[model samples]
Target: MTQKRISKELQECLTTPPAGIKVNLVDEGNIHNWNIVMDGPADSPYVGGKFQLLLVLPTEYPFKPPKINFKTRIYHPNVTFDEHGSMCIGILKSDSWKPSSRIPNVLTAIQQLLLEPVPDDAVEQGAAQKFKEDRKAFDKEARDMTKKYAK
Candidate 1:
């Protein structure tokens, strides 16, 4: 059931992706794991940067939310270091996730997060502090890191 839904979603995303985003399966056999490439929103601080994300679906999806993490290193308040890449988005959490939410929505939310970070609930403490204190420096570092890894 989970596989079927994921397969359909994957097909749809591949056929018609939203602007500035692309999705592909990480492995041929694993429909549960996906590789996402998102272009930074236009005119934003992150503009012209490409970002990579990993999406892993649970065995019981819909009923359970998929896990999303950054595969490309990004300096962001909501993403942690150590390459663990845990995201700090409300929709990814159990408390906020809804059964009706789909992969497209998740991807959209992640892109939105890049444009507007939620510093109060941070997974990367240093990035969050920098973002709060020095917006310009944070933007520069984020843009540099995005160019380095997302290219």
Candidate 2:
């Protein structure tokens, strides 16, 4: 039942994706896992980059939030450093996630996160510091990393 709901949502997202983002199942048989690629929003530091994330649904999904982790290494304050690429978004976390939220909402939130990072709660301290102290350098590093990974 959970898988069916997720599959239906995936189909809806694929057919009518939010602006500059795409979502699909990681494998045909795995409705519990999804692969998402987001195009950076215009005028943001992440512009021109394609970011990837893995979304894993728990057995009791919708009631429980899905797990989201970045598959592409990015130079972002919200993404973790250890190459694990974990995101520091509120909605993805258990505390803030809502059962009513859909896949499109999650992907949109991620894209918005790229455009405007939540520096107060940062996963990558260095990147967060850079973002706050040196805007140009931060942008450069983010752009460079995007070029390398977001293919």
Index of the highest-lDDT prediction: 1
Question: C-alpha displacement of 1 in model 2, angstroms?
Answer: 3.3
State each model's CA lDDT, in order: 0.86, 0.85
Q: Which stretches of candidate 1 lie over 4 Å from their true place?
A: none
Q: Backbone clashes per model, in order?
A: 0, 0
lDDT of 1 by residue, 5-103 (tens): 888888989999878899988998989999999898875567888878889999999789999988777788988865778888889889889988998
TM-score of 1: 0.93
Q: Which tens-of-lDDT digit does each residue in 7-65 have in candidate 2?
A: 77888988998999888888988788888888888988778888888889998998899
TM-score of each: 0.93, 0.93
- CA deviation > 4 Å runs, candidate 2: none
